[model samples]
Target: MKEKTSSNAPTDTELKKWQGSSVREKLVQLQSIFETTKDAKLHTIAIGSSHVSFFYLSSMAAEEKIYDEFIPKLINAGEKSIKSMLEAVDSANTGELQKVLSEIVSGKTAVFLNNEKQVYLITFRNKAKRSIEEPNSEHIIRGSHDGFIEDLESNMSILRYRIQNPDLTFEVMELGKKNKAKTAIAYLKTSYDPELLKEVKRRISYIDTEIMLTPGYLEEYIEDDPWSFFPQMLNSERPDRVISNLVDGRIALIMDGSPTVLIVPTTFFAFYQSTDDYNSRWISSTFIRLLRLASFIIAINLPAFYISIIGFHLEVIPQELIVQMKNSVEGIPYPPIFEAMLMELTIELIREAGVRLPSPISQTIGIVGGLVIGDAVVQAGLISNLMIVVVAVTAVSSYVVPSNEMSTTVRLLRFPLMIMASIFGFLGMTFGVIFILVKLCKLESFGRPYFAPAAPFNLQGLTDTFIRLPIWLKKEKSNKTGSGIFNKKKSSARGWEKNEN
Candidate 1:
């Protein structure tokens, strides 16, 4: 980059200082920059009477593109004809030495032209990338199966396809130091707050980190609360999910080489909701949401409740079930907390193992390993069958949350609650729940309510927080200003009913 350029200037648009005003001098400076790399190819090729020099990285397989698509199409008569041919193809002339070097490093071909007033950058970047396919973790039976690939341009195209509005904006920023990465942010200009977008950009700008390999890296750096267990930002692989929130006036952070995108200013309820919820009937969707909420409760509190009952409040167990439970735990040498922790950690270990192993073996390990471990634990009286049932159900319930980050938070929140329950019975669980609620209410994601609706109690937000409204009852929300609050787009979606009446 140019020494005169502000150090904080985003690398994507920043210009680099040129060595001289000639094409040959620019090529010499380019070679000097990559003097140590053997993969860098700088050559002088003749076209008619004129010889122009070009520079590219050989490792990117750009030579084939230059010969196949570039040379034959553009180089017949000389510099003048070359200029005309460049107008027909995707190419740009940049005087910034660093900009051209960045393009070359990223696999694009840079040719010097206009006597080095500007370097011609042509698109010869790697063409092969992961095909758009369904995301494994966020798959839905009734929603769009297409997910984002590692390429940022392709992801932006997917978003554009779904949101064809003119206000939709996609801007790229260079993140990391020494090894800068292209990080992009997408949002609808009219829908989101300009100040909010500015703050996001500002935070990204001031970051002093050297690498941002994934959206997670960006999320961690920019999130408001680093110490909080709750994720202030939501990460998702589904394009439909991202666009839905994008239309809702949220910002999406995308990184090159990472499929995951981070959506900011998300509420707690967003994690509990899914794309399929809209695809199904409203009644079914509401029911499923309720089920998920119930699962959330059960997942975090089930084992803890068991500990309270067995260790502190035995009388709360029903007389009919008391004998079965007592008999089951009678032979166990450890306390309820011990058994609960053992089983929970074991389940987490199995999950991690399954994830790390190959697909075929992971499935086998999750199923066969879980079954064998549970059966053996119960048979040996190390863990009760009742406890096994509770742990298994809890594991399933934690995974019910659509967002994996939130799901993990739920899994982790269980331990502290379990410890509290074991010590003070229902009272400890009460404190735990109260503390979590207080934290949620107090936390803010990008200066927006993280808990949302419930904390501020916006009636409109609440309408779709716990239970979604029927499609017929739902009205479109449009933000004319930058408030990012719900404003009725129209009087009604079913206004025909009033006319008929």
Candidate 2:
């Protein structure tokens, strides 16, 4: 009996060598490699008196397309060779066992002719996927309603539809060892910084892992500071958003099986800007933009600020209000810190429970938990009325942030500030803020400063950072060139004077 090869044995070089010309021998080798899985199918067909063996995974291969369309075409085409008969788009002839195995696993059927050295691999992937719909997470009041689906090709097509420019380039690469998930890097060839592109490619190539489940897994490997609370790369399901970032000279990474695509070298300001800002009038957009910025501050600082004031700085309150506040918390059993933590934890649990349950049931839970349970807690004197208002406002403010990752970061950051405020009162919260600022200043996103137009202080870039400047007035500035690339002479954006009577 032939000695069986170990499954863990290296097959890179061995697979490159042709596995004997015998069809039955090849079948035995493939069955062994695939562990005789039921999904691995071998279909035998006689094409013009030549017996050909077609191998593919039933779960991945398009069964109807293969049996009806491809097989009939092959049988009718009385070509001299198997390669000539399988002359479809993306069709290739290969002798290497490695190539044949890879093609079959990737939803391509491999046609093996008896006594023939080469195998014809044809692409026939047709998997069921979710239909294109507006993303629930990044919904906009006015804009393109379509969002990216799980299929990488569909996502790329959506991006192509938005920007038909030829300069927009996409380079594909494979990640993960066992699964080998496909990943694509997209960027405008004309605008993208060469160094930035090289850096992104280098980082992705260096990701050594066994399995990459989603873009989030790859993100953890590529981000500059993995420990930082702020996400260096922005994740979005909207194709328009991806196109906009690509136009801005940034690179986008789209992973197979993940609906959300990632944008790199992003600034803190990018997270705050919404697609609605571009759709609406400049004045209204600017107002909402400023409101979002205010909400960020309120979300992170409100709880701690309340804890400091009520616990330490009672003198700040007016006499009548002070009396009212004292009366409100008079019967509360626990300290301010304990009371705040308990309410925060309860809200977090309810929020999580709502998220985990079905949509209709979750909505019911939110109403009952937010109103009924909150009122019960107040009446029981477990938490003060002011504390309830503070927690609710903070939660609402957090939702105002456009990026979900940033919103989550804001929620997580409050815990440390709350702890500090409990121990050191206002001083503790002040120190926590200072530490965060220092960290933000030190952080880098793909080697670009995270806090741009604010820390490094770019006047031209600042025009659109906090406020939504009119698109016509906004000048195209190269992120790499800084002020050197700006046009010296300013033209009337609207050309209103030329039309004047």
Candidate 3:
């Protein structure tokens, strides 16, 4: 039997005093603190002549290791302290009760020694997690299939394997007051801007929330423009994508339990880029990049442009097209705006259904909703045949975007543009275009221009924006200075030619 403290009802200050005279008193205090939780496991065992108390969360801690390995080894070791008896792969001694509790919650077994007034935190965390698999959203034709997993340590290992440089540094901090989530900020120390890093850290520290569920939740707090439709930070599940951004002097935020990592200070063009671009030939990559850019424009304004030209600016269309469009819309009851809205809403509903249902069912819903409903609506004379064609083309174009967030933004932006076109014709679309351009120009990602290598144009950065130049032609420069625009400082990839000859 171990000694118990005299004070039965200890104050908060007394409870915090980890240097209690008796291990039983400390154990009682901890038990009282976690009495409401049924999963909390406290086991009392004898190690040598001293009494040892082990505390861990049953849901998270490895029970097999504790029972099979730790207990057997501890009982066999004679006349040894609790710390000396256990042969854990990793162990740490701490006197603070708060630290001990934290370790227990984090899936480590906390061993309390009665004789020494010391606590040893042993790591035996073996929680089940999803194996690393290719990301469904950011799929590529020819690249590494591996992606970030829900496990933070595994994600860190993936990053470390790609970039083995000493300059790759990670600064970790916990976020949220009640549900503390681990977050790590990764950057290349040699190339990343010190000011930018400081700003990012400051913003993270400023976040005072009760719970952070995902990286997306944290993103809203850290973003410069929360109201803007455009995403300021790039979210990627691919380690290759994250590694590429890190090499470009950008900072990456990796949150525990979230496969998606956020890369900061990104430009609009970055969202359009796919991992396939770097893997393919430069000319082919350039063509695909340009095609995606064109898709962005078409996805946003195709319906609106069609409405404006047919309704108000029919003179601009060739006489034969005007005649064809007039015949198509002649029997339709609703105006161009109403017709467009109906189709858009239907498509959105189908899309939402597809997402919520199972994979096979979702595919069925897409085919049934798209083919059956769309064809039926046209045959019923509810929507014009030409309008169906226009909407179909627009939907296909939106799918071409590499980033899902950007694709969503493109989908949303067309509604307002369509309304504007209905009221003011071609003039409304021009104003809408200008408004979007100005917003993009004004938007900043961590104080760096969001519409980089374009508005406030940098001629050099243009090399890889709409068209990717050959890797050999690409120059190495500080990301802080160019800010996505290439500068005059260049390196020759053919410098070894003299030695070869």
Give lDDT tens digits, candidate 3, residues 1-501. Answer: 344553233356855565754677877777776666668889987755677778888998998999898778777765454466654448888877666766777789988777567778888897888988999998899989989989888899899999988899989888976556889999998778898899999999899988898999999999999999999999999999998888888999999999999999899999999999999999999999999999999999999998998789888888778788788888999888999999999999999999999999999999999899999998999999989999999999998999999999999999999999999999999899899999999999999899987977877788888888777766675668333434344446666865785
Query: How does each model score on TM-score?
Result: 0.91, 0.94, 0.94
Candidate 1 segments exceeding 4 Å error: 1-18, 478-491, 498-501
| lDDT of prediction 1 | 0.81
Q: Rank the candidates by TM-score, best first.
A: 2, 3, 1
Residue 437's lDDT within candidate 2 is 87
Count: clashes, candidate 3: 2
Leading candidate by lDDT: 3
lDDT of 2 at 136: 88
Model 1 RMSD to the real structure?
A: 4.4
Q: After superposition, how far is residue 134 of candidate 2 from its true place, in Å?
A: 0.9
Poorest 10 consecutive residues of model 2 by lDDT? 479-488
Find the 10 residues in a row with the least total lDDT in model 3: 1-10
Which is better, 1 or 2, measured by TM-score? 2
Candidate 2 colliding pairs: none
